[model samples]
Target: MRNNKEVNAVQATKTADYCLAIIRGRYPSLAPAEQKAAFFILEHPESAAEMTSVQLAAAAGVSESTVVKCCQRLGFTGFSQLKLALVRELATSREGAFGEVEPGDDVPTICDKIFTATLQAVEDTAKVLDPCEVALAAEAIFKARRIFFFGVGSSAVVAQDAQLKFMRIGMTAHSYLDTHAQLTQAALLAPDDAAVVITYSGRTREATDVIELARECGA
Candidate 1:
């Protein structure tokens, strides 16, 4: 039997992980309000902890209802409860906060700082890029008889790029944006085949369905 605080803590942990996963996978597809909420939480989590629903809504340029809804969607009871959980998460996670800039910084100086920050972001990303995972993916693709690429919107561009690269290398790769086309390809994918699901928001129902169908066909 967990107390309210304990239950809230557990929910917060789950919500934090869920939000991070969504931001990593489906950020590009987030609605404007959701995107703003996501970025605020990721970039300035400490501040997010102190914000009231109204203040946070103003910061994100969303309605208070949106803020409440976002909190509920993330598994918190409401804004206050979400803030409490955020505080706890921030205390435990050692992730660096994004540096803030004053409005007075000159353009060139700000540009240089932004450039340095971008480099740091790239370095951080590279630290987690496992070579073993790359090798495994390459092996899977190389040995598969066929490949289906799934993505939507901007991610669709990335999927198409992957398809083209594989095709240029003489692999049978197909990328689809339409529901019917994806369904057709997914239905045809076999146990000997593989599928590369590409979506920033791994939650896109249509794209995810295609990936699911591919697995159903034993890809």
Candidate 2:
């Protein structure tokens, strides 16, 4: 029979992966206190290892009860369990939360690293995306009378690419980088139109305004 230590070892690995997945997928839906705790754990995982629940709660500007409750919501029994899983995961992860561009890297090395990072990102995204959700989105696009691609910065590039893909399929599609043009276009949209806003990081307040405008216009 497997020993207690062996069972715990397995649980630890699963806990780390599971907790991170929950944080990523359910963060926006979490309460403000829980969101604070979750973001604290994500942004300062190493610090979390050394801090007690009270300390972490203070740092996150939440109560100790909130810390424990957040852990429970994240699928752990309590704060200590959550911390153990997070610390274990952080210990094993080599890459920081974001992608890194190292200094003194040669052109070929940079290219190789960038390509590898991109592949890893796509793989990670695929793991999180539900096939059913993709099917629903595809069906919605198919039935739309018109489509608008809305985004800015790197997400803008993604929006433009989507515009191109729909255009190639002979669909009526539009994407504008200019704020005025985007507002004007959105204002002209009707209930028959649809807007697809792509913001991977979920940090696009300006793009959100455009979407709100489109929504108000009955798009």
Candidate 3:
């Protein structure tokens, strides 16, 4: 069993990682000043959580309004709300919130860590996902004349699996592992088609290109 200080430290680390993940997901779309503020928060989540809006702005070399705008862009109401969220996360985080396998771990330990990590991922996704948006996406897919799935790297494998499943359900679905092939398919997409772009980091160049082409084609 760990003492209070140790537990608090672990929770703070977990919260920081979670907050960083959110910021990173939104990094590509943020404005320059907002991105700078986000970068600072990513590098120093604990310190950012404790700092005032003005202090964080000075530290990130941005204006105070930029910090507040960054927080809002990150889905928070303001800097104060972002700070509150960080504090809440730190307080509510459980032990082993992010399970990691250590070297020389036995079979059972490895299995436990893997399973814990999976559960944590699912829970975190649930926390951020919007049910209304999911419903809209599902509706769009259902109404589409065809579906185009675009991805690269490991996400390409997932796109292929999605294609197979959609095909099994008697839907016209296409996915290509090659970047050129993906762009070609995207270019052929009609206005009635639906395109699903998958990327783990949300910053994959190939995935972005595919989405751009699909959108240009009115998919």
Candidate 4:
């Protein structure tokens, strides 16, 4: 028979996975202020789980109301519920899928860990995606006259790959490695154009500039 501790561990794992999946899946659609709070929770789930709404808002450089709204957007009742979910998730993650490699680990062990982490990431993403949002985004892209992809550092590689794929399908797509070129392209975007900003962390100045300019130009 399972002990109380084992049962609690399993429950925590399930709750944590659900909470994290929601945050990841809805992140792109959140407002800039709400995204700030959500990104903080994603990057510091353990710390965020322990913080009050005001404290989390301060840490994330957003307002307290933003934090509350972010929680609501994720389908939580309030900050308290979000905190509870994060706390449970952190409890189960202490040595779970996100575990880091130790110096003494073998190559096979490292490979296994990498594969496990990759699988877990994919599973979490699959859980939180909203079908409506996906369909809307797909339809927008399908109808766009041109598409602009923006990114920096490693994300730029992804942007370039996307640009190549779209071009292969006979769509006009652009991805610039230069910041100046990106801004220039963004300024020329019309209402019929679409822009996709790709970044691991949503706080980069370059990405913010591109998004703002693209929106201003009615992309």
Among the numbered candidates, top TM-score falls to 3
Off by over 4 Å in 1: 1-29, 39-44, 58-64, 72-85, 88-143, 152-154, 164-182, 203-206
What TM-score fits each model?
0.56, 0.60, 0.66, 0.64
Cα lDDT for residue 203, candidate 1: 78
How do the residues 36-152 of candidate 4 rate in per-residue lDDT, one tens digit apiece? 998888777788888999999999999999999998877777999889887776676642334457899999999998887687678786655545567888888999999889998
TM-score of 2: 0.60
Q: How many backbone clashes can be found in candidate 2?
A: 0
Order candidates by TM-score, high to low. Answer: 3, 4, 2, 1
Is candidate 1 or 4 superior in lDDT? Answer: 4
For every candidate in turn, the CA RMSD to the true structure comes to: 7.0, 9.1, 10.5, 10.6
Instruction: List clashing residue pairs in candidate 2.
Output: none
For candidate 3, the C-alpha RMSD (Å) to the true structure equals 10.5
Weakest 10 consecutive residues of candidate 2 by summed lDDT:
92-101
Instruction: Give the alpha carbon lDDT tens digit for every residue of 1-219 in model 3.
Output: 457897666544544446644665677778998988988876676777799999999999999999999888777768987787666655666334333478989999999879876775676676556565688889989999999888898999999999999999999998888889998888889999999999986778888888888889988
Model 4 weakest 10-residue run by lDDT: 92-101
The top-ranked prediction according to lDDT is 4
